[model samples]
Target: MERTLLIKNMVCDRCKTTVLELLKTEGFKVQSVALGEVVVKDASKKDDIRLKTALQAIGFELIQEEADVLVEKMKLALIKQMDKGDADFILSKIAEDLGKHYSFLSKTFSQLEGITLEKYLINLKIEKVKEYIQLKQLNFSEIAYSLNYKSSSHLAKQFKSITGMSMTAYKKLQESDRKGLDKIV
Candidate 1:
């Protein structure tokens, strides 16, 4: 039998690769792995328990609730938007792609995650800004424009607000204070 499992904290391609390898190592006939989900063939009850234990050991989670799954999907959708540098597309993209209303998504994410969706998104973007700053390839203006901020100042304000320091200060202390994408929430 083929089984699909919804996972939490799968925020990037590396996460997919990690999960795929782990599933294979556990002797499941892995079918596919994507952010927040995986499919495996010939799984049994014992397999479920073993897989859960393995996943937890690596900072991943086996999500069971339908609402929790939806929240994870919303998080992945937002992460995709951030990767594409299309910051303003959150509302429409999530609504159309997930087939849910913005209000519903926002409410559900807040209720499940203990933070508003908007704050969660801001955290994601701030982390990206930190990454770009660490790379030192893009100036503040370019970074702000690429992430779709109104202006570098606007981006700076948000960055400082979220990170508790100005971009310049962050640049000075650039010793990898960045959080893993999965730890954003």
Candidate 2:
């Protein structure tokens, strides 16, 4: 039977890779590893304990909840779509793809994570913008467009609101001085 495991702090591609490697080394048949989940083809209680320990050792915790797992999946999917720099996505599209009401998911996420889904998405987008700015490869307008902002001014306004500084000021600051998303909160 395939079992889905909830993992905390498993937020990025690197985490997915690490989890997959750990599972493989431990002899579990991992079907897939995503942002906050691991699908195993056949798993037992012993395997579960070992997997939990392995993940915990690397600063991740295994959770137990189908709803929570689905919530995490939703968050990850949104993040991935945003990261792709696609402008086609909106809340309704996400809700439809997840087969759940946007209001319900947003409410559940806010209640559980103490942050609205929109806020989380904004944070992720801002982080990506910061990365692009640091790279010095893309101009503000391009970054804004790539991120699906209505315009450069709109992106700047939102960026300033969130980071308390203009994009120009941020770009001038030393990269080493920049704060990460986790540090922002």
Candidate 3:
């Protein structure tokens, strides 16, 4: 039998790799590992207990509540939208993709996270801006376009507003200033 486990704090490819490796090393037949969930084969109750413990030991947690699961799903969806660089009707798109109403998702996200989903997304976008600036491959205009901002000026304004400093200033700062995606909220 296959069992699917909802995981928390899995926000990047490295996290996925870590979870997959841990599962394999712990003698579980891993079916797949995604950002927020994993599927394993023929796992008994003892295996699940061990798996939960192991995952928690490494900063990941098994999501037991359905509401938490939905929130995680929404977060993953928002991340995917950001990666796509198409912010047009993004909330609706996410709701459609997740098969949930936008109002419910928005409400649940704010209630559970104590922060509006839009605010969380803005934070994520700011972090992405920091990443792009650090890469030095794209100019301000390109970064703005890629991130769905109206213009470079707009992007710079939001960046400054969120970071308390200009983009150029942030670029001058150490890379350690950037926050991890999972740590955005």
C-alpha RMSD by candidate, in order: 1.5, 2.4, 1.7
Best by TM-score: 1
Instruction: Point out where model 1 deviates above 4 Å.
Output: none
Please give, for residues 66-114, the per-residue lDDT of candidate 1 as tens digits.
8998899888888887887777765657868888887898898899889
Scanning candidate 2 in windows of ten residues, the lowest lDDT window is: 176-185
Against the unseen true structure, what C-alpha lDDT does each candidate score? 0.87, 0.78, 0.86
Winning candidate number (lDDT): 1
Per-residue lDDT of model 3, residues 40-83, tens digit only: 89988777778889999999988878889988988887777767
Please provide the root mean square deviation of candidate 3 (C-alpha atoms, Å).
Answer: 1.7
Clashing pairs in 2: none
Q: RMSD in Å for candidate 1, one decimal?
A: 1.5
What TM-score goes with each of the models? 0.93, 0.86, 0.92
Error of 2 at 141 (Å): 0.9
Error of 3 at 139 (Å): 1.1
Give the per-residue lDDT digits (tens) of candidate 2, residues 58-111. Answer: 777787676676667666677668656674568667778888998988888888
